[model samples]
Every structure is written in structure tokens, then in C-alpha cells.
Target: MTESADDAVLALPDRTLLILDDDRPFLTRLARAMERRGFEVTEADTVAAGLVAVDKTPPAFAVVDMRLEDGNGIEVIRRLKEKRPEARAIILTGYGNIATAVTAVKLGAVDYLAKPADADEVFAALMAESDDKAVPPENPMSADRVRWEHIQRVYELCDRNVSETARRLNMHRRTLQRILAKRAPR
Candidate 1:
């Protein structure tokens, strides 16, 4: 089902939202956050469960983590869109990459955001594009399409040490410090 920009703008009533993620802690945190916003939320730890949940009871919106233990989030998004074409979707990914981002958008995701994303950021991404509009070009990282694939590798190699991570990336410790400060809330 194809939806246009105008179709996205249709006001989303207060309704149940679905979130798909394999990490139990993250899923719990996300559900609580969305609940705080007056949205009833349901969570699934696997793509198959998420699909089944939507089939049983369609949600108003969905936030799907790109990587799942059993399957990828893009598959969940596809099934959700198929089951409930009107449900708005936002892709959440820790394994951010250009291919995944493009695939999510092509599969009908409203926006793609990196993991550790704050609840506000997640909600904004889904709502902001209710008009199905493309993200603004001026937005950094929004259009860059280059996922921080190197950052994780460096972080792992550095044993999650900010100083070492900075050194390996050939960037100032303070710069890496600033980026670390903005990691999504767990």
C-alpha cells in the first residue's frame, strides 16, 4: 500500500503503538517512554512476534529496531505496513548503514534513526514525517547516508575508552567526548 505526503499528515489519534526490539531492556525502556506520552504500547522481541501482534491487533504506529535476534526490523516494518497500511513506522537501528536506511524507506518507514535514540527523537522522527516528506537536506547525518560504521569498530577496539577511541579515529578526545555525550538514552 502506497501512501503520499498528504496521507501522512492525517492527524494520528491517541492510540496503541508497537515497538520491535530484541533487547529486553531497551524494549522495556521504549515501552515506558511511549507510555509516558499517553500512548499505549506493545512490544515484541522478535520480528515474527511483531508480525503476529500486528496481525492480531493493528497499532497506530510502530518503531522497529533494525537488528533483531531472529530477523531484521525491516521485515517487521514490511509486514506491519502490509497488515495495517495506515500505521506510521520509524526505523531504529544500532547497526546503521546506507543499505538498511534505503531499504527501510523503500519499505515504507517514515524515518530512520540510529540506536540509543531518545524517546523524543524517535517520536519526532515518526511524527515529523507524517506528511511522508523527506528529511531536510540541511540536517547533518540525515542526508549524509554514511552510517558511523567505523565508530563502533573503533569503540570496540578501544575497549570502549573515549580517549583510545578518539586516538584511533585520529580525532580529538574532546570531540569524541562530545559525540559520546549525545548517545541515545537506554
Candidate 2:
């Protein structure tokens, strides 16, 4: 009977979930909890590395920490969508900004969860996953909007290099030069 039950559990559909968070303890606990629920989890401590993980294996769901030592989580959500448009995204964040939360929702995340999100909350967001598409429709200022969504993406990709930022964006070095030139020094 035990053998039969084990086989039955093994027969269940496999769900791939990617977790991106800088907190090692939280990430490990989160991964283990989901694993107990039958999900295969992949983890990354940095946004740049997380993007590579998604590129290597597209996940059905992603739980992102809003803040990272290397960068913010929203950009990770946006990049995941770019890679696998259908992957459901849940933002697990300690820093809750109404504007950022609303902006995250606009980018295609299924839900924005505050940090300390429990297994139940994670499961609930996963259950609430939808293919309804990003809100407000796609637009020309998408680059700008996504840029505005979070500056971390650019920072992560550029390795904080402004010269390389232009290269990655495929714009003239001088063009990126002009754009940043307009911004007040941080």
C-alpha cells in the first residue's frame, strides 16, 4: 500500500518553480516548502543569475523577493516574462510601495506579496495564476516604462557600467550618453 501511494505521488504533474532572493535562509526554506508540495525548485541569489536560470529552464512559476543585494525584484519579474511570457510571477517583498506594487501588476505579475509570505500565500498566488495578459496592453514607451519600473535591471545587466548599458540596449553609445546626461546624478 505504501508503495502504491508513493507511486501515485510520483505520477503527479511536475511543476517547475524558480525562486530569486538574496536571503539564503528564506530561499532555502521556501524551496524546501515548495519541494514538499511536489514542485521542482531552482534558486538564484542575484537577479542576473536568476535570469540565466530562467533562460536555461523556463519555470511554470516564479517567486521573487522585492529587494536583493544586487538589485530589485521587479526587473527579475519583467525579464522572466520576456523569457517565458506565460510563467506566473509572485513578488515577495519586504519593502512595499503602493506605486511599485501597482507598477509590478502592470508588468504581468500574478500577484505582489509582501515579505514573510508563507507557503499558503505562495500557494494562493500560484493558484491565482492567469494567462489574461499584462494589464494596460503593450505600448511603445514599454522600454521607458520598464526602465521606470525599476532601475536595477539596467544596473544588473550593465554590471553598473554605463558604457556597456548602451551596448546591451543596442543604441548608440552617444544616445545612451545623452539619456543619462539628462538625469540628475544619483
Candidate 3:
């Protein structure tokens, strides 16, 4: 008799999970949910704090927000990999982009998920034995939505500087401001 894949995931004993996010409420909720799922959850609000926590006790798994108050979540994932090479990591972000997603994967993250991911999705990503089982997006973002998100991510990368963002994007400052002023397209 052999244990099924689901059984193997459920049988993972009280593994430690480090969750890094600036959103306090979401972090707390996710920590609790993962805890209930048999993980010892550690929470951090910034990349610095998360790095400190990782140094103190490297978790077997990590779920990191792509954006943090102090820095990008990629730093956390990189540090965790340094401390524990086999540690599984996932990147979660509200601002998803192809560049950042590729960077996350390059930095040793097993998966990248957009924001509003529930515990089930996070768990599945962490417990996955192979990338072959990765699910394709059910409803991929529209081109307009992708462009909007990319502009927003670039703006953030430029520290919310309208002029710099415009320069980097090769657009007029006023035009960038107008785009930023409007609500993001769905």
C-alpha cells in the first residue's frame, strides 16, 4: 500500500511556515489558517523583520508578499534560500507582472500568486511535489488589465514619483498622472 499525494501533504508534520506581508489583518488571518493546517506559523510585516525571523529560525516553508513596507519580498525569499536551501517558498503580490514573476522563480520561489489567494491555494502551492501539477489561470488577465498593472508596478518601483515613472516609461509626466489618477481597469 502507498500513501496518496494528498496523504503525503497532510502527513507533513508540524512544519514551520514563515509568512511575510505588510497587511496586518491578512497576515494574521493567513497565519491562523496555516496554523490550523498543522504548520507553526511565523509572521512578519517587513522584509527586514522577516529576514531577522528567518535568521532566528529558518522555516521549512515561506509565503512572502511581493511588496513590503521596507523592501521587495524577493529579498526575503533569497535570504531564506541562503539559510535553508531546501525551504519551499511562494511569492504573493497584488501587483503581478511577468518580470517579477520570473525573478521570483529565479530566486527559488516555487510559485507566484496574485493577491486575494486563500489558504487552500497557498497550501496547494506549498505542498505540490512537482511543477507539472501547476494549474493554469482560469481567467487570465485582459491586456488592458495587464498594462494597468504593469504601469502601477513601474510607478511603485520608481517610488511613486510621477516624473521618474514617466521618464522610465517614456511617457509625459501629466499623462502618467492622469493614468494614475483613474481607477485601475478590471
TM-score of each prediction: 0.66, 0.62, 0.86
For TM-score, candidate 1 versus 2, the one ahead is 1
lDDT tens per residue, model 2, 1-186? 254432433464647889999989989999998888777899899988887888898787899887888887888888888988888888887654456678788887888776667786776677652654433322223455445334435644478687687677776777766666564222
Q: Which candidate wins on TM-score?
A: 3
Please count the clashing residue pairs in each candidate, in the order shown: 2, 1, 0
Q: Against the unseen true structure, what C-alpha lDDT does each candidate score?
A: 0.77, 0.73, 0.90
Single out the weakest 10-residue window by summed lDDT for candidate 1.
Answer: 138-147
| Tens digits of lDDT, candidate 3, 1-186 | 997645665687648899999999999999999887778889999999999999999999999999887889999999999999999999999888888999999989999998878998898899887546788876778788888989988997899999999999999999989999998776
Q: After the best TM-score superposition of candidate 3, give how far the Cα of residue 153 lies from its true spot, in angstroms.
A: 4.2
lDDT score for candidate 3 against the true structure = 0.90
Order of models, best lDDT first: 3, 1, 2
